[model samples]
Target: MTGARMRVALSARGVEVDDGAGGVLAPWGDVDRVTAFALGTVRYVSFDLVNGHSVEVDDGAPEWDEMVAALPAHVDGGVDDLPAALAALAHDDPVLVVGAPVLPR
Candidate 1:
């Protein structure tokens, strides 16, 4: 199977450089570092019905912030990998928890 690829861009502050013409400043003041990576296929699955009953679960859905928080800390490769990354989060059974809150006595 063909693996997915991704690119990342990083920026920072540094000293300036002079241009060749009469010590003039360079057109582009700062520079950015870009990197690429190849990631294998990732998948995530969620079973809405547990023990043959529909249960309220946290599947990283409903809101963009919640979904983003559920994703892996480090994600790279092409945009296609986004689905796979999300899938990975879904498959991550450890992080999944019941959304219900405990009632006070």
Candidate 2:
């Protein structure tokens, strides 16, 4: 089966105070999850991958909610769908992509 996936970098208008250990933190703000397909024009908070940092964001946005919607639906699809799905991501959002070994069936 065909599949897709993509995640753009998102920018934050908020402050990321450095942790005592020199790490960074995102205290949750607005968020938007945009893929190639948007049920409708979308505008909201965004997140992305950068050293596996964590942040908070609103879930009301189309992208964010859509991501959740796709989870159960993409049970047998490939990873390619991610790119198109994440196209709407805020070009500056920070996110982490952790992958594991999938045993061959």
Candidate 3:
């Protein structure tokens, strides 16, 4: 069966900070902050079907409820349906993608 999947890249850059000893800056210092980025394909499941319903597995899937709950109350079954579903899933789990980047504030 076809399903939603995304191929993403997670990148992190260290932040520069003071040495506190009042010494010269170095190339690699303590990492106070971090920046990340996610780049890749974002495929979503096709919500539209000719008399077909989406199937979801519950066993071995702890976040099933959250994922389903994320769906919109009323699905239009249009081109944006998939995107809406993906957005819902993202809301439930920010890092839903396998290689989704995690950025630090």
Candidate 4:
């Protein structure tokens, strides 16, 4: 999705991304995995759905910081080193923030 105009947040049901006109609502149960990373000056969070689709949002999103802070509480098996990875703006290797290391398809 477009980065700057996006608004990502953790709703009571799951993750929501509003892009002004319309948005996507990925319910918690539909999410099979999650990842986070940073590249240049942008930090990203990706939600991988059980249906094999995905949604990604970046630091440009309005509620990005809030979504990142609330991730550990909402997701299971999230990596503890997320803060470190996100701080490394020069790197882009995605860090697992939820679900198993190897997803079961």
Candidate 5:
């Protein structure tokens, strides 16, 4: 039998470094939101169900604000981009949430 490799969840809290032309990038800053690994200001994990897909994000609110504050410059994104209580099985997993309030087409 072929054994499947285990995948550790990538919980890198960040903000959307947008191009300002309507595109964005990452590491606005990465954060840890495992609750137990309370390394930064991780507020409530934001989650949303859109287009039949469920997405959760952590944006340092009530707690996560510190992570967002440390950045030199960043844009505010919705529940999906915060990278909070969210989970992704693999790289190929569908990213239902992208920008703030913008759902996958």
Candidate 6:
């Protein structure tokens, strides 16, 4: 998440993240889901992989809007209440944007 400017891109293969230092490719078949949360005014988006790891990108990065807009193409249920979820950032809760909505208790 830290490094020059971040770049997030979507492709037929999957989500690609480049932080200027290095890059990570989260393939479509390997992705478990996607999640988003806000800390202060910044929004953090994560691509959760089936292998138990994840890649995160922030709103400060370029292509952030494009990536968010393209989520529905790759993730089930996409982000139905993104505006509302972001509005509730003061509560500091991470919302599930894809796959299932339920979070662990």
Best candidate, TM-score-wise? 4
Model 4 alpha-carbon drift over 4 Å, by segment = 89-97, 100-105
Task: Pick out the ten consecutive residues of candidate 5 with the lowest summed lDDT.
Answer: 1-10
TM per candidate comes to 0.16, 0.20, 0.18, 0.73, 0.19, 0.71
* Best of the candidates, lDDT: 4
Error of 3 at 75 (Å): 3.5
Question: Which tens-of-lDDT digit does each residue in 29-57 have in candidate 6?
Answer: 77777777777777777778789987777
The alpha-carbon deviation from the true structure for residue 99 of candidate 3, after best TM-score superposition, in angstroms, is 32
Kindly list the per-residue Cα lDDT of model 2 for residues 3-89, writing each as its tens digit: 122221222322233323453443223212221222244323223324353333333432355444443232223444453444545
Model 2 / residue 15 / CA error / Å = 22
List the lowest-lDDT window of 10 residues for candidate 6: 96-105
Stretches of model 6 off by over 4 angstroms after superposition = 19-23, 81-88, 100-105
- In order, candidate lDDTs are 0.26, 0.32, 0.27, 0.69, 0.29, 0.67
Better of 4 and 6 by lDDT: 4
Model 3, runs deviating above 4 Å: 1-48, 51-54, 73-105
> Model 4, 1-105: lDDT tens per residue?
536776777766777878878987878878888877666777777888889987887777667677767776676664675556566645646564655223223
Ranking by TM-score: 4, 6, 2, 5, 3, 1
Question: Candidate 3 residues 1-105, lDDT tens each?
Answer: 121331111113321122333322211122222111112333232222223332222212333344334332222223234334443453234333211112334
**lDDT score for residue 63 of model 3:** 36
Residue 48 in candidate 3 has what lDDT?
Answer: 21
